[model samples]
Target chain A: MTRFRRPSAPSRLPLPPLAAQAAGFALTRLLRRIARRKPAILSRLGPHGGARFLIDLRDSPLLLLMEPGARRITAHPRRAVPRHDAAIRGRLPAFLAMLHGVEDGDALFFSGELEIAGDTSAVLALRNALDDAELDLTEELAAIPGRPFDGWLRRASGFAARQSGLALSRQEAMR
Target chain B: MMELVCPAGTPAALRAAVDAGAHAVYCGFADETNARNFPGLNFSRPELAEGIAYAAARGVRVLVAINTFPRAGDQAIWHRAVADAHAAGAHAVILADLGLIAHAAEAHPGLRLHLSVQAAAANPDAINLYAEAFGIRRVVLPRVLTVDEIAATNREIEVETEVFVFGGLCVMAEGRCSLSSWATGLSPNMNGVCSPASHVAYAEVGGHNEARLGGLLIHRTPKGAPVPYPTLCKGCFTAPATPSGPAQTGHLFEDPVSLDATELIPKLQKAGVTALKIEGRQRSRAYVAQVVRAFRAAVEAADAGAPMPAGLLAKLTEGQAATTGAYAKTWR
Candidate 1:
């Protein structure tokens, strides 16, 4: 294991530059891992379906994840509606009535609150896959120390420091 | 001189605004088609027609705001609102939402269309895009630009520009915030209400009053210390501690400050704003009359190259603080 000199200040001290970089790198890696698993979730939803959604972000980022392939859709901050297409753009009450069947996760990826740009079908499919997956990155990230990146880097660098014989600094130790 | 477009939630408010020297008065029908869907607010069909006649008698114009997005599969309601406004002799109808604007353009060719701030078309390109596509005569700017940005926008867009000069302020881009819907499942764009009263609940716990919206505690304040309505973006929250220090407590999004642009009337006129809008369609007629009268005096002073009148509506404020809000870069 790496070790390093400890910094003096505990509360008010800033993280060393190396620690920050390590944290950022770990975050990117984790994000990539999630992205890689996205296809696995999509495959379960079949291949060509679409769901419209609205995500309300009161407690968390309101998402409208949809999986058109698997004919699955879900939402959060539940209102009413299963799907709203361009054809039903003006009947809000009816759309809301349909929203009642939706779950919180379904709204997160496919809701009207999110404006979907190009590849609408693909986005809808991606949303479904995301909703069905047992991923809880938001919760996991929340529990981590510092901003998500800082937490990852601090832990990674701390491990590296222990193997190196350098004394772990106070700043690194607290992180 | 620039036209003064004032809000009139009620028939009495409309008459009072016209009497107080508003060049034009904007109002909405008493229904879900309008943003201020509060009970006992807005005008009836006959009242709208009468208000229009009254404004016409005084050489003032009346614009109807049918600004809410039509619900999906139910376009008739919004279509009727546009048709009714035209039938009632409104000078124009303010609108947002692409689908609704397209429908109005096709259905009511003769009626003028002014883009509402809900469009959030801040840049010149977006403004021009709407003007070119829908023949929008005027665009009510979102409260996100500085005077310099407004001036630049005026130079680029062919349509007239209207800016809010006083009253309620929104920190985020209007129609783009999901904070309300996230908590209460109602949105300003879709439901025409933000931090709606139906979803808000207040409780006194210990010596503090806690403001809860959709069952989430948003603000806790000392009793009788003037608890601001818990608008999600303007509430105080705790940010977790960072490596740099412990957690910080304060408004993470924005402060509870209303926009009072009276002092910037001349600068806005110089920036080529065609009209000045005063928000508050849910206000009392007395509030409407007082604000309109003060703004009229200020506009007249601006036209004459004189200083604005001082401290006009000190008593009208909710918490005794006002901001120019993003009109100056200092807001950022």
Candidate 2:
């Protein structure tokens, strides 16, 4: 069991330098676990006119390449400028929150937080796959062996609730 | 008594809305024909037929939404939806696109027609045109008008006006906003999904958590701080650096809040509004039941000239923030 001090200051960089590589490996393992539980999700990917999804984690070394129907989708960190059908660019937490159901995808997209490009049909197909499967990402992550990442999830949730400014805003509105 | 038209994403939600005192519950087929097109939501032909029967037996009404624009090449799917809605004995077929309305009016003349809010027909001229051309009975007014504007439009148009009194608020002009498509590559007009669920990904980076839609960063929060669902309009973004200024990021269009017009029930009555619509068909049956029961009491009290209840649904709203939307003549 490994323990670390609480992060007193948030990193200004997009992702922590050391955590990116480990996170990518962890994410790949986690995703494989999820796909195993729900193979039907991956099935929504292959037939979308040969679309490959590029997930770009800015400020991090993890450039996840997802090839629809091709074996071993996340060809982890290969070479320069991956040839792909579509790419989703963001930090690590954004991806985690979505897969974990801590946030809503449509809501994020509407907010201009998530950007999608390339063939939309491919993105739509991916969306359909996950929707059909309905896996609880947070729960699955918590159940992952060799790590207790549940603490981070719980802390993240508590952070969202506080930042929401529920009482302050509503009270101001009433006034 | 003023009629309350509630939303029903599923048959169970339909029953819950009706039982909680909705005069009419609106639903749609499981396709791109309606706005609330999500997975595992909506009814099939047999299910819709059964829902209609269930509502009719209890002195309630069922409205079918064939509201989304019918694709140019494959209009038959939507046509089949309209025909099936009429066959299922729906009280009215809610429509948005002019061509589909024309098709419904020409083919199913006897079926009642209600103009959907997706049309964004804000003024009297547009409402009158829809009423005259398609014989539309009611128009679900968009959330872009003040109550006074609604009353003014009501005086000019012949059709009954239904206004959304509660639920989520859309800041963009309905049916016109393409921000979702710009970001997600999926158009709500064509796919019936805005910021679709499949493309969303969230993760924690550094000591903060970030949310993304499609792939663009919309929101970031200090780790363990509340981050809202990135509904492009409501998501926080850094505005492009302006002249003599640096980039400022915030919820530029609107906040991650819901619309709750519970207080304006009496004022809307004076505006000659025909029906009060609650916008959340995609919500659960329990949510439908709770909102309907509360609104039912509020409407009933208003009819009797009693004091309106205070903050009856303060807790149900997302982020516990509610606004009157355009009814109060304010920005979202």
Candidate 3:
């Protein structure tokens, strides 16, 4: 199939400004959880052992800087080299969904929901690295709560989605 | 009764299809033998056996698709796939290559064979040849036939016929197209993947987002707008115009709309189609379940002479666009 030109859709409801704080809170939990869980999932993503990345979550003022393959992950890291190895741009919920394996990156790219700019190979390596881990977002998120996390996650994500009018930013909170 | 055959990319999707009322669930091993050679998809040998048993318990059958063509030097892989599917108790095996079909028919004479759509058996002669030589019991007809042509061919061929009722559509004649290989050096025939992800690149230029397949521009969409997977035939390109001022640049062949013949189910059944196929093995379990449930209702309504559900699968279609492709005589 080809040429699925989307009729001009009203832009997805932008993440509410107030929700950005909550998104940051959720994102920190997700990153820390993933770091602890997969440990080295992004270790091989950097090329030449110095690939730096900037993740831009649309509709939010937050910017994340990462040095892939390095043990330490710095949020909004300072870059002596003006250019990052790559920049991945998308809404926070989309990235969380992609990280959780609930959403397809190919589909998101096709639908113009996600964008990658800069070193294509680095992005590809990152995708492969994360995919190889086969991390379960649901199960990992459950590590936050004691039991019955699935139901709690669903309800939280739903509540977050309703308040923020965001896709899955709230559920990603538990991450 | 017309059979509603569905696809399952994962074991979960397979179970979902069976639970949603598929007459037969078609899947493949997680390798190059299947058309959808996506990573993190498909079943292992043990998983296939489990899937078959699950379907059997529900009185639903499972068909194994090993439809990609065998490489000249290594036909053993394809042969092994057929033997394994048989050993796993698949109700039938869907095949495409001539030699492979011959080998299966000769080695296991009792096994039921269905000619894959990749064979592109469009006419009566090809169908008859496959039936007589390989003992193929069914042929998945290509998407190029009109309803009238299908009825006419059914009158001439002895084997049962199946047509795609929902899911993706290919404008080119199946099994014979080289557009993908021309650009990407991989095709459904040899690599079992068309428009592989490795070669796909999406870039933003100016204000529009462009999708490229093997570095060739497939289509460009407005910033923040939806773009389709860069399948070569479905891309937007400029074609030289006849004595016109400027070349035409647009979806030159077919738009990125999926095939949805739910409205035409009764007509296709009347045309003597023995089975209806849904053409996505790389979809999610939710997608598989929804499409199967809707199509099951449609097929049942057609069989019982009841009014079919209207717009039952509109949201599930590609970009919310669907068509009754090549089914009407007017299309030809």
Candidate 4:
């Protein structure tokens, strides 16, 4: 199993200007939702100290979240960082080492492929929490038409086309 | 004629496969270069050289598998494996990682490159990307595509395609799954092991036996029933339901079934697959010999336009039943 690396920012493509702008706005909204849920989700992470982290996904924009004492959580969207939190970052494999070891409150940041923006320790706790949560939202996400903006980005970026080897058939893409 | 590639985890297995009529025998180094990084399996450098010599003497080819992705900053070890395999007279080196493939193609232009199944090159576009970017000569297609899809893919791609005909089946996309890593720190792409035996624990709970992998309760069965290994994807689990219904419990992803594409041999050959690979490098030498001989006979029958063989190794499956898997359209 290859460890997940935060995908680097895509090289600017020759996409239609409006489509690119729409993608940017859509990504921002998605990050905000993730940011808003950080505190509530972190609270369920059991007891752990806070850490600062960054999340860099290929389909989504960058995310920087901080949890202090595993209670208060702050999120910064689309911000550049000086350095990644190696302590938390170095343990990416360890975070994935076991499913149950992940907690919601631990702060984690993505860099390189993923960049971390702030403190390292708290981020690790948050990562643990997310892993422990047995949230099965696949069907729910499937129910809502276009609920996951990331899926839309994948479609827009031609990744989904690559998956099916055909243009999004109108029916499948709509569902 | 289409090639008959076979699996050989050990030097003894390699010789046995050759004797049993394998056109090419694929094996990996004793470390993480291969997916079947099981204890007491695979070949050392000298062992591999000797195996290649033995195969060459018998007019059989030896292909070395160094398919695992090279870790960041740890390219040297994987690169060295590629170099050593080439030096040992391997017919080709099977690879998966993008960087590693690039390294091998540039550094050893003379060596033939076959894409490992772990690359998950399921579509014509992905296969073309690999062929265009790395000059890969052959691709081991993922076990996710239907026969029709395989035929379509063969039409669109420039490289020869290989498909699995027997052995363990992966429900998820090959090389893309993180379930094993999520449960056990070791992953197939990184450590070359999935649901490693070391991390497995079985316990008696509530008068039933529960099989746990990396501390997650993956399987629970009545005391007398056969308990399956807690491979993350194939295990039973409960998923929370929506507001409209109660939670559901079962094999949400897939049941524990091994693939047997023997029945589809003619269709697969017509679909233009260049070779059929049997997936079991960790299997016993006897098992390897048995499967290779059976498959070789099957392929020859298909080539001769004869009827399919009967009673072909019924006792070798994990369970009494076998599935055509994603080779047939209904599997999707």
Top candidate by TM-score: 3
Which one wins by DockQ: 2 or 3?
A: 3
For residues B116-136, could you state the per-residue lDDT of candidate 1 as single tens digits? 998888999998888888899
TM-score of each: 0.64, 0.67, 0.78, 0.63
Worst 10 residues of 1 chain B by lDDT: B312-321
Candidate 1 residue-wise lDDT at A9: 33
Top lDDT model: 3
Q: Residues A11-113, candidate 1, lDDT per residue (tens digit)?
A: 2344454543454355545445554654444343233333333332222222233333333334422233334431112122212222221112112111222
lDDT, candidate 4, A1-175, per-residue tens = 1234443444233344455356545545543444455433444332433333444333434333333343322323344442333222223332332222221111111111122223222333344234323222322233335656746654553564345333232211232
Instruction: Give the alpha carbon lDDT tens digit for every residue of B1-332 in model 3.
Output: 79999998767678878988999999998778988766456777988999999999999999999999998889999999999999999999999999999999998787899999999999999999999877999999999999989999999999999999888788888888899899989898777878876577777899988879889999888888777777887888888867757678877677787899888889889989999999877665556767888899899899899988978666556555678888863332
Candidate 3: which pairs clash? A2-B256
Supply the TM-score for candidate 2.
0.67
Top-DockQ structure, candidate number: 3
Task: State the number of backbone clashes in model 3.
Answer: 1
Give the per-residue lDDT of model 2 (tens digit) for B137-250.
999999988889998998998999999988888877888889888998766677777777556666668977677888888778775454555679888878778898998878
Question: Can you give the DockQ of every candidate in the order shown?
Answer: 0.01, 0.04, 0.17, 0.01
Report the Cα lDDT for residue A142, model 2: 56
Candidate 2 RMSD computed on C-alpha atoms after optimal superposition onto the true structure: 10.1
Decreasing lDDT order of the candidates = 3, 2, 4, 1
TM-score preference between candidates 1 and 4, better one:
1
